[model samples]
Target: MLLWRFVGRTNVILSNGVNWQRHSRVVKSALNRNVPIEKFASLTKRLFSVMGDGGRLLTFSTTLTEASRFILCLLSGTTALGHDFNTIVDNHSPFVAKYNEVMDSIASPLFLVFPKLETWFPRKHVIRKIDDLVNDFGKLLEDKKQRPGNDMLTYMLEEPEMTDEEFRDNMVVFFIAGHDTTAGAMSSFVYYLSKHPEAQVRARKEVVAALGKDEPNIENLRHMPFLQACIRESLRINTPIVSCLSLMVILSPILRAIIPDLCSNGKSYHIPAKASVIMNICAIHYNETYWPNPYKFDPTRFMNQGDGEEARIDASLWLPFALGPRQCPARNFAMYELRTLASMLLQQWEWNLPADSPHHDSIKNGFSPFALSLPKDMDIIFRRVEQ
Candidate 1:
């Protein structure tokens, strides 16, 4: 595989089948650690404090993006490194900058196939920076080996089967995925609800009823069904991972030379075995056959419980996190974070898009293959609600 030359084949991002099992186990085990409600509360307070007094407008596009970056960075550091947010921030790390630059450069099709060309392009500096970042992570892992801490890094290091290269690659993968993707989801949640005032009102009411003047906790979050529905709706509408690559197959020359077969398993048809198929998440989500009035932002689609909803849902049809064993390991974490952040936002403040903001108009146009495409200009205002 092309990625093997850059990042070792043992890395979870490139590994497959049996090879991926051990790495998956380590990641799931580490993430399973109880994340205290205090962490969400702390970040919520920081975000709420930044909004300021009435009429002082804020740009959701930039502001929430920054907030998500900080929150995710802090969470990743603490969860993976066992480092405090203050300690991590105080270190003035270059990881975030390098990560942003590398991700942006990788989004281009040129880099997807010929990543080495990144060495010659305008993003040449970023390619080098990413290598440095990966090396730095490797060194961090080495140091942890000498005196391991009780964190995700140490947990993986403790695993006898995990290699140094695999550890470093997994660290980078988790760092990038844990932050940017979750940020995109959170940003979308805020953006979508801002446009759907009725949904916002219902969500806020659900949140307030669940926790009256109390900080958001996992226990309380579970009971707020409407808020959860809104979250699912946001995820369905603006899936963070818009597309993903499927397996590769080799075929005989005769098979390849022919027009190819319309492969089907008594259900939907698939591409020929020789051709690679990119799972189009947006297309699946908008399939009106499964999702009635698909374009409309309606949370009710996921709400009917006793109506045999679980039995009826086609797992293949809705894949915001992708499907199968390779699906997102941190999905539960992402959902909890979105739920907590949205609950806090709605409970404490009344927010809406600026009258002249063009975000709503440009939302559909933002189609990014890397993650959920953000609105062109996300501008909204928040007014603190009286207790």
Candidate 2:
């Protein structure tokens, strides 16, 4: 159930700083390629269908997860391996299902503390599932070898340093990295908007006014600053990636005893050399000094920048993707995806959480320490706007 089981140490995410930079360059180049806009539009339309016929009430997270997974699967497949998972049957798609199963199993407390223990007792199933997924990647790699195309797989194959194992590892990394995080972020946005109906109305107004009859292409999306603000606020309030990255946080007694100087700074600070520390993204994002009424969902805090109307805000406090050289490399792509999806959702239909739904008031109470802090549930009604 561990990430290492799925992606070995050779992958970019688990590699050292120098190796990560080298591998990241290739991966980033592939991601930076022009995205398939039309395909995304078609996928969103399909998502609408998956949501409901017209006015049916459904679980919002369920619907969003499906749509998000579908889009990611399609995009990742085509861009990474030159394959198209769009044609696959819904709910029965093996690739998507297998990935979800692995994700769910890995999020368990048992798996987190005792990753190697997955081979014993009931946990062995998780190992088998991951092996199956890796085998699937192997098959895909074989097919790509037979018919190489202009894709990430092709780019990776061209790199003499990349092993077949590493290629398989990167494929899974891309899938996991992009899929649930985006979906969770979108869900959090909608959840907040649902709780704040006035904000939702204002956001919809901004989107409609900015892009009247035009499709939500990248250019038009930029004009809707309110929508962007809402996205950022949602990211700040409920960060999907809570912990930046895994850290060892080592404080060995032997080392401390041997060298008192290494344990503490000359003043008061103390830390063993090479000890790891994880940055709590959610805490920093919610700190009072950085954000007033940190618990409230307010998008206007990000608006009217450089104008005399509001005080200049500090940008360092915001780190939804973490900071430094290893910051989330796909930040731009993630924002683009959120904007496009938000535009389409607001423009096409009116949505709101049902009064009886558990998540009507807030999703804050349901936060769990998973890969992403997803809401327990959100049931919403999506009604088509009469043309």
Candidate 3:
């Protein structure tokens, strides 16, 4: 009920069967084709501007999080909705505020603990806000109908019988899953880089060699293997989404029939049918068997020594975006965004943790009601690189 109120019943994240297939097909098609490199570059410049022309210390966590959120929102808007919320420049964007409010209400401890309380003591205001947000998306859909473009909404419009409800619901899901997770990822990357200066230097050197004072293009981004490794390592260490949502269940009736009592792999414990299983991503990532010295922040693990190629990562072990058919549709898109932003930041500034930083010893996680890994009190001193 809580999820339905926010993302509706027809979103890709929560929906099942035909609804899931339809949503995933359309969304994956849209995200896969559209990289939006230029958009990422432009928004990155805006972010740099906001960060100031600097050889000074900054509370990077706050600014980076805000910039990442706005950049991702804009990206999602342009690619998904064919609309510009102008959230990057306009900090007080009503739609962004309302969306945040809805998220906050959803993450409320009281409601999370006892969701049934929402039925007893209704959060009418939050529900109304969600409705308004959905209506706003509806307006975007109507606008897109008249002024169609090469975007997700336009593509969905071309579909035989794609409903407005489906469109709006998925848009809400994109807004929810798309931006926050990516922002959290960016934060984790920065946190790791701040702690590991040697890795940061290596990544920056690669970024400079690949993209010398030019914006990151797909061709250039491909050459920066070390930077990509750094991103991968950061994701492994502190994955943005900690665990797959408990709601996402493995409803394999055949498996249930075959192994009626208990199901077990050679390694892990047994699981009964209809069991509520949450794939603990952090545990898998930090497993000593797969990743030797798992706690160390080492990008070299993802690199091939002799060949200038990436090491073959076991997909089963390192699944920050989850695995298999239900993997995040925006995985490639998110990586592109990260690579773009991280490349730009690498080129523009050299950053290290402040001497008095709370995260000097280790990265500290911020409080979040959602299952997101967020860095807190991360102060990095950034020196502007002379062009």
Candidate 4:
């Protein structure tokens, strides 16, 4: 309830265009200019080089997790930390510790609901540790202020409308949301690629054709159809934000916050006045109403245009990143990382699993009853494609 008052519904931008203008500008400028992709290419290259080694690898493996941690730390540095993307990330021990700790433990939120029993339980440490790590971030931000020029944090601090408390909340939102969702969703992308060989092959062909021996840039990235389809597929199958709503929020001082997706097309979803309501992602995503053969893992479905069957699955059914005003400000940021990582993998390596391994579709608390969908413990072997 408290959080909702601050950020509103995740879909507010979609519904109230006029009111959303400033927030949109702030987010766009923050992501595009402040955290421009150029700063992080070195890290991408480093990761790509590792992919070229043809060594066996797996998602969330200690080594892979460490590499992922560095990339994510770099990502946060540019956006939330607002430091030299390279330097800040390497030196930020607290961030590395926080992120590494977050990854190592995935007890879920039961601890929050059961604090008393947490001590006697296994997951309690995760909560206590995460709280400590958040403090570590607070210190990092404080240290940045006395140092020098303003970065992302500095930019927010300059906002005349934002209070110190609001700024801190946004920071917490950044660290928690930024670290977990991006890495987790991308992990899903990797695991899906490993499990779905046909899609992987087709996706590589598209990457090679679109970027074709050229380094990935924002301009060229727009043309990669297969790569985009793979990303869309990964996001669709594993939505990062399971559900969202602003039903209880008011519009004016008189009426509460306006409901998003209010009477879309002709259908109206009843939103109780002054009550928290949610939009079920999986329900809408996998609904046969929107997607034909919804259960199938087919990226081509997104590419299909001529056939009406494929047309149904078009864009409507996919909601990996929730839509509207409060949607992820870092959608493109996350996508760039996913696409770059994926293209490099497909272009340079062929991934496989142990013959005895079973294809596990991941089991994090997701959609209907829990947190976002995630895939973990996925192991794969890579054979380098010789130049």
Candidate 5:
């Protein structure tokens, strides 16, 4: 009920069967077509301009969160809706504010604990705001119909069976997924890099060697193996989403009879006809069996050993983007964004945690109303690198 209130039931993330196929096909194609590297580069440059040069102590958690939101809002808006939110310049954009409000309301601990209270004592104001946001999406769809462009909405309109509600719901899902989660991941990257100067130095060296005074492109990003390892390690140590949404599966009677048990970690349990299973991402990522000294921030685990040997870790163990066909459709896009931004930061500045900062020992988790795990009050001292 809470999720439906936010993204509705028809978005690609939660939808099933033919509906899922249709939504996934269009979303994946749109994301594949639009890489947005130039957009990310330009926006990041603007962000640097806003931050200014020189040795400055900046609060990274706030800065990165806002920058990520602005960049992603523009990216998702332009690609999916053929609109520019202009949130980077105008921080108080009405649409963005309303969207944030809706997300916060959905993440309210009170409502989450007692979901029935929402039904019994309805928050009419929040409901009205949600409806208003949907109506705003409806307006965007109408505008696209009159003035079609090379965007996802234009492509989705080609589907005869698609509904307006489905389109709006998917847009909300894209906004939530592309904005906050990526922001949290970026925060984790900075937190890890700040705490470990060795990893940061190695990553910067690779970035500089690959593309000195040049903008990062897809080919250049591919060559930064150490930087890639840093990203993977950061993701493993602090997965953005601690736990995925519950996945409910209905088992057939015949199948249940044939396979009456499910096994995990040398333990077996009888299966019921229907069960809601939630994947605890944090537990798997930190499991001692899979990762040695799991709490340690070591990027070498992902690095290739000497003599062209590949890392022997199982691919399934890494579930930051999840696994299987239902994996995030925008995985490539998100990775490119991360790599590009990280490269830009490395090229322009050398940053470390402030002497008086609280995160000297460990990265503190921020309070997020949503599923994302964020770094709290991260203040990094950045020195501009001489060209």
Candidate 6:
């Protein structure tokens, strides 16, 4: 719930790019250029190799191809837990199975109408699944700590980390934030790029140029300015998370009487003092006053070297990971995932729109209040690039 709360810190986000430098300093080991990029490149190459001639239908990659929501979840784990456990999550995690079910059963609207349902009364099925994930991973970490392995879990364990309770709490927070947020962002990236083939081509060119007959290295990905811009643009336009919801006020129950009713609205009359209220996040991204041609899909808007009024107008456009002290802690890790996957995908695969793919304007990327946008059920054809 805290992860999803609004901080109204849009203007201050990039303000602390210096602080971003500081905090990002700690996770540099995890984001170590060699391990993450190499693992991701290997994963992407292998996933594509599954699409070889005669098109032998593969299971895991097909699952990834379809359940990208889950793929993003695993990718989050890939970053958080490192490459060691990603395959375990891909093949073995029951939570992965159950999460997809919860998503399939509950569409976004019901939550929008009743955000309280998320806090007070989550679906029993979802709750069980979540509990299962937390408990299972918690135990796994504990076990690994005893074994003292070289992976991230052991690193956290032996490194004089938090108490057991704190570890468990952090895991709960970590898993949810790490998984849900990345899934949300990647879905948007895939969906938007799918819609805009020109941008996709540009991304492909950037990646191929960077990966020229060699594995993607951190240096190459860092230098791919156009691809990074595309990811940033995708994130800007299709901010997977819209806004954090909050009850109008946080008055204690004992002193609640004098509070104005916020929930009275849609009650056919006055709203109650303490009803749940959603912050309008997409409004910030799409604001016409701030953004020129707000409705137009353009990533170049972020990089435009406009002078006079235009550059001033372009300053504040997007933050899908969110803003403020409450902004995502795993942002560095997320960049690793987005850039690495993008680099490898572009380097190895050639994507073409599936037949009958809808136009960008016609496609309706689903939005679940907090989830800014969702990837529609779109099939992308991928063939290995000929050397």
lDDT against the true structure, each candidate: 0.69, 0.71, 0.79, 0.58, 0.78, 0.55
Give candidate 5's TM-score.
Answer: 0.90
Weakest 10 consecutive residues of candidate 1 by summed lDDT: 262-271
lDDT of 1 by residue, 198-265 (tens): 99998888889989989888788877877887878888888777887565655545444443442222
How many clashes show up in model 2?
0
lDDT of model 1 at position 222: 74
Which pairs of residues have clashing backbones in candidate 2?
none
The lDDT, on a scale of 0 to 1, for candidate 4 is 0.58
- Where is model 6 more than 4 Å wrong at Cα? 1-35, 53-65, 82-93, 102-130, 148-152, 158-161, 245-278, 304-316, 358-360, 366-372
Ranking by lDDT: 3, 5, 2, 1, 4, 6
What TM-score would candidate 2 get against the native?
Answer: 0.84
How well does candidate 6 score on lDDT at residue 211?
73
lDDT top scorer: 3
lDDT comparison, 1 vs 5, better candidate: 5
Q: What is the lDDT of residue 103 in candidate 3?
A: 78
Candidate 3 positional error at 387, Å: 1.5
Q: Is candidate 2 or 5 superior in lDDT?
A: 5
Give the winner by TM-score: 1 or 5: 5
Residue 325 miss distance in model 2 (angstroms): 1.1
Decide which is better by lDDT, 1 or 3. Answer: 3
Off by over 4 Å in 5: 53-63, 148-151, 158-161, 252-265, 307-313
lDDT at 111, model 3: 82
2 or 3, greater by TM-score: 3
List runs of model 3 lying over 4 Å from the truth.
53-62, 247-270
Of candidate 3, the 10-residue stretch with the lowest lDDT total is 260-269
